[model samples]
Target: MLRRLLVSLVVFLVVGAIGSYGLMRNALATPICYFDSVDEVSVIGQTGHIHIGTLDNVNAWVGTYLIDLDFETAYDVYDGRYEGYCIEDIYSPDNEGGYALYDAEGSSANYEAAAYLFNQYASSVSSNAERAGLQLAIWEAVFDYGSYNLTQGNGNFYVYNGYLSSAITYANTYLNSLNLFNPDTFNASGYGLVSDDNPLSLDPQCYQDYIIANPIPEPSTMILLSSLAIGLFGVFGIRKRLLRG
Candidate 1:
């Protein structure tokens, strides 16, 4: 009877560990989302295509949406569809900061601001104009140095609109509405940075970010799951000794 109890407990632990590990794997995995479609007439594509990447605050996000590779010059990646399994993060640790995000010493800060921008004002985007505006707002936060302004550089960091345009104007509206809203205070847990090196983006002024309704578990949850296996082992040892006695 004792041996049978022990076997059942061991089996339960094994099953639980396997299930937990599978869940953790799915949670920690890099997210996969579809570009779906875009309202812009970019040469990239009207569907399953978008452009985004950044280098720093000093350099403009030329044809960038969320993932630029360097600061020496904005490398354009305007060729892949990135529909199902064509996107990848070419982040190199020793590429001399081959990416502007890290070169400018503001990678984390940029993402925080970008994430905030997405969370704060990405829901009402129903048109190309709104999308452009949101993208511009995200860029302002991402390329932000010590201050936040989209029109303050010799031409490197300056972007403007001629009339009552929706893109640029809407972006300013986003910046203005969130005056005291600190990006640091924002909680960006469910979202992640999606990047691709194929089919570089075309126009930087019309870049944008979109949403997908898929959420994954956090890193902490993964830790909790991993710890379960060790804990179960300990419990099993204690039970085995007790049963013997």
Candidate 2:
């Protein structure tokens, strides 16, 4: 009887450990950021900076390589701080930044600029598919840097790490979907100063968007279910052994 109890306990511990580990692994695989209402303003503000900065950086990187445009010129086009031909002027409100070029349209000037740049770069490449691929790669790098900066930067409160984590999660999903960063083929030579160490999965973003779109089992819930399963299996196994004996 003692031996049987020991066996059951051992089984329970082993099963619990396995279940906990599996839950942890799953949690790590699909990181979810949890936040309270207080974090909304900060998160939104930081995300905005990330978005604008990324656009400016991508324009700079691509324009420098393809058209030999200087960094200051590229910066002025996207950054609202400067006057004339600024993309922010078209999309955001007057109080938000620069003067509006036109009445608010379907797409913002930021996106318009991005599309224009993509087309310009695409025309330079001989292969249509390669051109699309290169554009995607540049976009991916831009977002990757944005997400990385948001998560790692000192913009948000350290206690509210979830805000940054959420940002990174969203960014990762968007960038990963593009499928442009294959280790074998992607060459970052002319793509500005994109760090080799910066990978997509590490950064997280868009938690609110992601959570609404994808509702997955919580880690606690998963562990609870796993424990219940282990208990049931142990009970059944013990009953079978008793019957056999």
Highest lDDT: give the candidate number.
1
Could you tell me how far off, in angstroms, the CA of residue 116 lies in candidate 1 after the best superposition?
0.8
Q: What digit string (tens of lDDT, one per residue) describes model 2 on residues 1-245?
A: 74677577667766776776555534322223211111111111122222332222121111112111111221122211211112211122112211112111112222222333332343444432333233333333433332322333432211123333433444344344433423333321111111111111213221111001112333445566666677668867977888898
Q: For model 2, state the Cα shift of residue 147 in Å.
A: 17
Q: Worst 10-residue stretch by lDDT in candidate 1? A: 97-106
Candidate 2, run of 10 with poorest lDDT = 36-45
Query: Clashes per prediction?
Result: 19, 9
**Candidate 2: pairs in clash:** 166-205, 167-204, 167-205, 168-203, 168-204, 168-205, 169-204, 169-205, 170-205
Candidate 1 lDDT tens digits, 1-245: 65676677667666766675455434422332222222212211012111223322322212223222221212222323221101112122232211111111112555555555666676556565666566666655654533556553422233533421446667788777666555455555545443321122212322333221113344445445556667677767887788789
**CA lDDT scores, all candidates in order:** 0.41, 0.30
Report the number of backbone clashes for model 1. 19
Best by TM-score: 1
Give TM per candidate.
0.44, 0.23
